[model samples]
Target chain A: MNIKPLGDRVVIKKIEVEEKTKGGIVLPNSAKEQPQMAEVLAVGPAIANDEKRKDEIKVGDKVIFSKYAGTEVKLDGEEYTILKLNDILAVVE
Target chain B: MNIKPLGDRVVIKKIEVEEKTKGGIVLPNSAKEQPQMAEVLAVGPAIANDEKRKDEIKVGDKVIFSKYAGTEVKLDGEEYTILKLNDILAVVE
Candidate 1:
């Protein structure tokens, strides 16, 4: 990919949710809000401070981030978001 | 003021825009957008990783943050926002 995030920023590809949950329950459109999970595509280089960029998150890691955390951008006709590392709430283990 | 953010989150009190500018020009209502400046009221405790919480930001620091970076909340009829430290772009100094 041509995109490279800089300074604590991360590029994320949103994960598509299936129509049915893992238990085989079909979700109605209203109940299926945008998924808060995404796969990390790229992470920025280290930032100015020692605190913000320990680089714990890596590419290919599936993470859950805050619902309203990123800026939407289009890449190669695919939608992605650019978020700061701190916006990532949890790493899905 | 009573709200305390958790896990790299920060509480911010937005700075209001005055009708008059510093150069003595009165800005019309349309000219004034929401100010992205705020005072840091509180910061959350550190997160799981050493990466996310070097804690460069501190309470009472004046900062500039992303325009859409936080969740608006009402506290005792006062407005505030809870943001991650990464949402804070720069210190006003």
Candidate 2:
């Protein structure tokens, strides 16, 4: 699906968490904190500046995002969200 | 206290949640979701771009952030974190 964000928003796909615990025990979904990780799929036009410069984030970068930043939806068998670029917590190197 | 962030990082003071619920029920620390909100205290020099542009966030902007984004520290009786600007979830209006 071609997902695009408006303004400084970004579209992200949540990265699923592993089902196993550190000690090798299988964990139920309810036992884990929702993983705050994502894969960037699209970014909006950068916030404009007085100098008419535009900065943009690239697609396909792995990012760490807040657990609650955007409205969530499932499209084409995948989950995605439209969030502000500033809502992204950090870009994972 | 004076705090400065390195690179795209920002220094934020965690906003304290109300100890009581809107229904007038007192809530213990353990019973509430950790408030993922902060007040921006300082911002780092903006990341450099090929265009030599630096976009900086201003001080005193109340922001909503993730529950876990940066290393926590206490400076002069206040708790703060040095988090990358990308870690900020959204600039709360």
Candidate 3:
């Protein structure tokens, strides 16, 4: 990807929601809700340094973000959401 | 009026969507899209300190947030959304 987020923005790759349960009942696409979680791919320089900002999030973190948040953009044929640092709700443990 | 969000969370009071334009064509409540913006009221302790977190938001700042981002709750008969710092998209200039 040729995009680098500026300031405290980040690039997130969506994580797919489950299509089935433990009982093995398959679910249609409409039956599933989009996952509100994503993996952090690239983080901006403003948040990468502890001196500039309290860096709680990092690349490769499995994070939960707000639904309907961030602007979606296509990069190299893959979809990504560009979000400010505050758009991420939590860092999943 | 009596809510305080925890961690990186914040309390947002919704800014109602414009029901009419200057041309005076009034819009019904159903016709208006929910405004994706709000005013910052109460901020969490974790986000108040610069050493703890870089505070980009403050009380009374007009902010734009994701419409479906935060958890909604009723406080004192008014609706408010409690959101993490990341859920806030930007502070309006």
Candidate 4:
């Protein structure tokens, strides 16, 4: 990505919601809520004086973020969300 | 006044919008947008490693905060807004 996130911000790509159930039933798009799960594409530098928060999120990590917490951006015809570190609720284990 | 803000949060009471213009003409409520100015009532402890941010805001200071940036709260029948430091736009002179 050409864009670099600055100051405790993260760039993420939303993971597409699964369209099929395990039982082979297809689900309609309207039936699924917007997915909160995202993959970390790039992470900004840590804020000064916050050592513990540094390295907690790394590229390729799957994370769950709060709904309505990020700014959406379009780059190279692809969509991404930029979020503050505080917006990330948890790392998907 | 009894509720304490936590984790870099600040409690503020919105300053009422002026109802009269300098020319002494009365203005209707609809003529005014929600005021962003407020009086700082209380402040929470600073986050670790951010000493510069500490003491930047204090009780009794007049401040301007970002619109839609705080949580509305009620205490003892009075309304207040709890906002993070990041939501505070500037300290009014």
Candidate 5:
């Protein structure tokens, strides 16, 4: 099932990093490194201010989020995170 | 100078993890682990959601944050990240 967050929360599908090094060395799960990127699946409506402002991100945007930004959730056999709009560092176009 | 975020940004002081192991083993910087903790330093005003609601965190609180949630900015003699409030997972009282 798809889990969507309410309010300013966002749902992001994590991009898995390669388990092998450039030199063809294999890495264990414990040794796996965190990636600096992710794909945006959904964003919550802007946290209501005086008015609802448009959020800077949209669906399918590839983004760079802080290394520590969203709550983790497992969905549809994959892992995803629900982050607040502020947790997003930069939208990678 | 402190780099306070202008909007829903929060300033966090990274908690340096121990470079040693249970057996007194030494870990290199490259082999260093990311800590699941940080201390809150400052928080920006709520992004005007109709009215400013009180934030869930405050200064000096130790917190658990998403492993990928903020922008890294080096201020003064230390490194800190400015995350959106949503990036914060749970505060350690």
Candidate 6:
């Protein structure tokens, strides 16, 4: 990824939900809502420079974000979401 | 107003659109879009503490904000909007 986010924005890759059930039945894409969970791919310079937020969110962190938040973009045939730091609700440990 | 905004939020009172036209035709509320201009009532601590923004926005300053931004609130029979500082697009001189 050659793209870098500006301000306090973050780049995240959505973590796809499991399609197969315990019974081995595969669910269709339409059966599920878009997952809000994502892996942080990059953090913007503002967040990086902020002493408080720099330690809170980092690249490779698994996070849960607001469902309706972020702008979706396709880069190199891969989809990612760019959103402000405030949109990320929690970091999943 | 007794309301105090948190974080980088601000409280603003919307400037009502003129109902009467030059030809003496009175336009109904439904005929016009809500005005995006407002008067800054108060600014949050974070914005006030920031050296750059403190000089940029001040109480009683007229400002233009994003159309869909801010949370509407009714207080003491008057209406107001509470929004983040980022939602304020420009200060009207």
The best candidate by TM-score is 3
Error of 4 at A74 (Å): 42
Best by lDDT: 6
Instruction: Show model 4 residue runs off by greater than 4 Å.
Output: A1-93, B21-25, B28-31, B47-49
Question: For residues B5-59, what per-residue lDDT tens digits would candidate 4 score against the true structure?
Answer: 5446677899987688888998886787888899998776443336887667789
Give the CAPRI rating of model 4: incorrect
Which residues of candidate 5, in runs, are more than 4 Å off? A47-55, B1-93
Cα distance off (Å), candidate 5, residue B13: 21
lDDT: worst 10-residue window of model 4 chain A: A47-56
**B-chain TM-scores per prediction:** 0.78, 0.77, 0.83, 0.81, 0.80, 0.89
lDDT tens digits by residue: candidate 2, A2-92: 8767777788888776767779998887788766667888777654331322333458877656567789988888778888766664454
TM-score of each: 0.46, 0.50, 0.51, 0.46, 0.47, 0.49
Clashes of each: 1, 3, 4, 0, 16, 0
- TM-score: which is higher, 4 or 5? 5
Q: In model 6, what lDDT does residue B17 have?
A: 75
lDDT of each: 0.74, 0.68, 0.76, 0.75, 0.70, 0.80
TM-score of 5: 0.47
Q: What is the lDDT, from 0 to 100, of the residue A69 in candidate 6?
A: 91
Looking only at chain B, model 2 earns a TM-score of 0.77
Rank order (by lDDT, best first): 6, 3, 4, 1, 5, 2
Q: Which ten residues in a row have the lowest lDDT in candidate 5 chain A?
A: A47-56
Native contacts recovered by model 4: 0.00
Give a tens-digit lDDT track for model 1, residues B1-93.
Answer: 377688878899998757688899999856897777689888787632445344456689776677878899986898899988767755545
What is the C-alpha local distance difference test score of candidate 3?
0.76
Interface RMSD of each: 9.2, 9.0, 7.9, 10.7, 7.3, 10.4
